[model samples]
Target: MLQIIVAMMLFFVMMFGIGFILNMLMKTTWFPIYLYLIVLLPLGIYYTWDDSMNFAQNMGAYTIVDYLPAITALAGAYISGTAIRSLRRGGYKMF
Candidate 1:
């Protein structure tokens, strides 16, 4: 449980850091971040699978198939929130 929390926190921090940098360096459109995430997430999941498997084993019968989609949705939510903030801050033009 604790390990999972730590892993999740690390994942969020890393993703957000990257997103923040991109937002600073270029257009803050969620579209590109969305696409980047599609590529990055699978690699993240692959790297984290062992830890996830251990955590799941502790809980019983959790598969990557069962969890990946939910995690991806969570990632999307984070990116959306970041994009919304950037838009609100006038980083992006509405018109």
Candidate 2:
């Protein structure tokens, strides 16, 4: 549906912008990926966790619409790191 596509694009753009800024500030290429894995991923899981439901039930609740946004966000994080790395390699000292 249109909503799913919108959500995916929104998540991707938000992650990319945040990651880009973080990379510039931290001067690290891969920090966004670590932050996404260590922080965002666990927080998302915790938010969706259900005490009454079994692990399988909780995990099975996710559909393509849910997973797509996550995938796009992760891709955004990775691409942001690559972009920074490319800039650094290209002799862009500001990046």
Candidate 3:
């Protein structure tokens, strides 16, 4: 349990760092989300292909749930950073 917690913390920290750098360079929330997915999707496929094949043989389908954590982490970091910047600029409306 502790290991899992630590792993999650590390994952979020890494994601946030990447998002922060991208945000700083690009200054766009949506672009970071796209960049994160583009980078992670192939890596996720490479890592999970065998497991997903085995599971698909039995379950008739594979799902995106395996990649949700990383995706969510990137998105959350991007949104959080964007929100912080917006708040600092006195533009709180996200819509």
Say which candidate scores most in TM-score. Answer: 2
Q: After superposition, how far is residue 25 of candidate 3 from its true place, in Å?
A: 1.0
- Number of the top lDDT candidate: 2
List the global CA lDDT of all models.
Answer: 0.57, 0.94, 0.62
Clashes per candidate, residues 3 or more apart or on different chains: 0, 0, 0
TM-score of each: 0.49, 0.95, 0.60
**Pairs with steric clashes in candidate 1:** none
Per residue, candidate 1 scores C-alpha lDDT tens digits across 1-95 of 66656666665566656665555556554643674557765665566566535765644554554464446545744675566576668755541
Instruction: Write the number of the candidate with greater TM-score, choosing between 2 and 3.
Output: 2
Candidate 3 structure quality by residue, lDDT tens digits, 1-95: 56555655666777777766666667665665676678765676566556535755633444444344665577567765775576548854432
The sequence of per-residue lDDT tens digits that candidate 2 reaches over residues 11-68 is 8999999999999999999999999999999899999899999989998988888789
- Give the C-alpha lDDT of model 2: 0.94
Check candidate 3 and list the clashing pairs: none
Q: Which stretches of candidate 3 lie over 4 Å from their true place?
A: 51-72, 84-88, 91-95
